[model samples]
Target: MTVSVAALIVASPALAQEVQPVPAPEPSQVPLIRMAPAEDEQVEEPQDQGEDGEPASTELPPEPVVAIPQEWAPVPTTPEGRSAYGYYLAGRSALASGDTQQGAVLLQQANRLTPEQPRLREQAFTAAILAGDLKFAAGIVPDAPGVSPTITEAGQLIRGIETYLADGARKANRLLAERPVEMPHDRAATYAQVWIAAEAGDWNRALAAPPADFDPISTLVARSNRARLLEIRRRYEEAENEWKELTAHAVAGSLFRLGYGEFLERRRRGEEALALYTAAIQAGQAEPRIYLAQQRVMNKQRPPATLRYREGVAMSLRTAADQMVAQNANEFAAVYLRLSQQISPNAQTQAYIGQTLINGNLPGAGRAVLAEIPPSEGPLYANARAQRGMSFDKSGMNEEALAEFKLAAEAAPDDAPIVYALANMLIKMERFEEALEILNGPLLNTADQIYEVRFMRGAALEAVGRRAEAEAELNAALALQPNEPSALNYLGYLWVESGERVDEGIALIQRALAADPEDGHYLDSLGWGYFKSGKPEQALEPIEKAVAKEPANAEINDHLGDVYWALGRQKEAGFQWQRVLTLDVDDKRRAEVEAKLKDRLNQLPYDRVAPAVVPATQP
Candidate 1:
């Protein structure tokens, strides 16, 4: 998602005209059945080197490792059982390939054929939930008896939600209250109680103050819910006061501003509502609904009123979903998001679901969710396409990523984020000239002054051996944003590596470190700067710290080896150099590392001098 600075300079004004609205793919056309390669099976491309010789792409954080079951028991061998087993395998394969819809269908078939098979039933349930087929998931609850506690709880939650959606609040509350012990610490369940009360027209109880023990988010949600209910009841003054109090917090999100704006619009305060809408948009809240309302207001059209009851329910679910995401309860979050979507189907809700899936590392599922947003929803469509590009990039489908970015850029030619994303991808692909052309041509006359574009330009300049221009661009970037860590780090490392302005380099690096104290790359640069300044001993601690923080980083490892050799720890240096060979270093760096491995201390570029011997007789 990191775009090159130069590439981001392009004025994509023509891009929107070039992009046409595209329809979502049919379920049958969606290529969800493609299986991702296993980690061992994946062939890692050599990381591109940046201007400072670091990896061009930011390294993705390691995914949490989960233990897979070591064995699978053989399926039944009877003719009917065998047939079911085949279907089950196909279903699992489909799921692995990201085709949740097909997977669910196939798994459902398998479950029906082998009604007694717990594994088949469980898988079918999982697939259905992942596909957002809650109805199907609800139907299979009966078949999941005596399964794992997690599965049982999931079934209960699904059934509970279905009952709530189908029956009235009374029936749903009765059903949910039966399993209070199961959700002892469940924030969602607690919020649901408030929502049910509000649904049943008990405004006083619904607005009742939460307990002291309630979490900050829960407390905020409670207040917001009460305000929303007040607005619904046309208590304008009370609602206005509540909204002002809620939005006064610096941490208040777009949702609060949106609610307040709606309230203002409803009360015939056009200008005030428009100001709030503009502020929300300026604050980078890109939800389609907000943009539509803003446009409507600008044109003196009436902003549409959403049903207050549905809004209340959606808001509660959204708050719970946010909590679930914070807890890393991805499935639970998905369920809440899906429920919200069912009630509102707003662009904000859809975007939240897609983003949540992406954050959870379910890019395939995330792309599916994003695709559901229609192109007619301009803001959401552009945002979704950009996100889809990111998903492709994360999945290692670079070409597809490029295409998606291009599509998004065309759709919103003036959108800096999309243009920057496209350019960044090009930089990652090492198409430096193309990236530079975009920056210099389309972006030359553009008025937006983004520091990221300058920094990326500097990187591209360095990549193409235009060091002076790169240095100038970097300086320009620093001038624009003095404390930008990437620029400070890059420029500092460049000077340090070239054995120029050692003290200034060290100072810049220190500034960067002050900004981001735990950045392993910055630490390595500081250590390297020390070594370059003929203070190998001073380099030792920082280098070791950097190595400790990023043990697998090839550059850090190599730098450590150099520091060790300078300190006369030849054997330790050798081990570190050998370790570099096992890492994913670029070809040029690998060659240099290999040379160092062969020659050890002799291959190092440091100016090592023996200590002078003084005659004792002089004293």
Candidate 2:
């Protein structure tokens, strides 16, 4: 039931452009509300730029406004003594501008200066929620001065939002249970009940809440919540329909479409997914979740699309951009990344920018971006090291790439994922002994990584020609995850190669293909399944699909060559084998492909073929 790529790609672009953008106020206009200054002021003006060497004005700047005391607006401050008011204004401005770090800092300073200031305290509460620092928001919610019961109630509602974000609704619901009916924060109390019921897997309670009254901007939030609730209940068809409704009814400038787009992507509607994602990107609503989501979709496509949007953007912008990308619009992620870089200079962004460049088929550009961070010491350094290793490996510098992997492995010794990466890299270098040591030692001991360790151990053994050991390890992995596709394909393909249990191996590959219908590697496995069964003609379709999905995969291209040769298509077979030789295949495989190409060329008749060779396209 997979939708053809041709149908998805041909959809109208105008329909995609209809989703709304996220609303943002002009940069120069600061929303000002007053809070009274304490008699003892300990205000510290935010310095122009901190020692981190990032941009100073990338976040909110400080400003002054009128002071309010005892929950009422006080007289405006004189020019000479406005630092306290300035801190409050600056903090709120920072929060509104999506600069949570600066907002947090400024709000902290303002809270210290005016402990009894309700407006200042409320702003602090809002900042914590927006920053996703639930613990901080919880602390602030209990102790604020009641300056008008409504403001205090708003504070209480945020407390529920924080609790929901942190401990899920179970704890939040228990907390609300102790409150009396006359509690000052009923609205927040009601919302907490809704959140708790939904999180506790009770969709009926969540749906029973009064219809949400949201401003244009907040309406997006409401719709997203509704969509999530429906998704949680496993009402997928209904959820899809809700998303469709939201797409049509959501305001043109609303950010809710990111979530809807993601729903389409998860359903494997790639064309619709990509279109919605691109709309969000073009509307300047690129979020980090969107980028990651879109990347997942692209990875599942016939021809893998680049996932580099918002790679170097501010964390907030990156988050938003990722959300949009996740909704499936990876092509515009670059805009968010570049904008984040322009706003702030940080190693995290640099690493992302480099990775994005690599995904875009610009390994040289990736290296150039990474080179800017001389003597890398942070997360960006590790990221740059990984990218540099891939670049070196691609350029035929296996030893150099191994050194980089070693550095990355040493830097994050306890991280099982990094260990797996290093072990995989070692296998590629044909250093199977070293790979075996790493996987059998550290990776095996790590919790939750046992399956991956066992899988890699099998690969290492197979690379070193330890056939019996490889089979045992792969069999053990299958016992843990019976339908694990990588293990299934690898073990099945190995059996095919050895001409043992040919029918069983072919069935295994077909089952793997069913699980991951669009995966290029799995497609190649299925094609090889046909070849092993002596059905060369039957292998052609899957082989062609595999090549279409992963143009740069050396092994898939070689498999295609084998299929062509079996079909007596000598010219195409030679071209494919030559293409494999041009890629960064392992030394042994490279030599084998070269030998196969030469053997086939010699068998061709002198006058039957044209003199000039056809341009070879590799996997």
> TM-scores across all candidates?
0.67, 0.40
**What is the lDDT, from 0 to 100, of the residue 607 in candidate 2?**
28
Per-residue lDDT value at 595 in model 1: 82
Query: Cα deviation in Å at residue 335, candidate 1?
Result: 0.8
Per-residue alpha-carbon lDDT of candidate 1 for residues 169-221, written as tens digits (9 for 90 to 100): 76666676676414312455555556666676666656667656665545656
* Candidate 1 lDDT trough over 10 residues, lowest sum: 1-10
lDDT (C-alpha) at residue 80 in model 2: 56
Summarize candidate 2's per-residue lDDT along 517-542 as a digit string, tens digits: 99998888888878878898998899
Q: List per-prediction Cα lDDT, in the order shown.
A: 0.71, 0.60
Q: Give stretches of model 2 more than 4 Å off.
A: 1-19, 23-403, 443-448, 518-520, 534-619
Question: Candidate 1 — which pairs collide?
Answer: 3-424, 4-424, 5-453, 5-456, 6-457, 9-443, 11-442, 15-410
Candidate 2, which ten residues in sequence have the lowest lDDT sum?
1-10
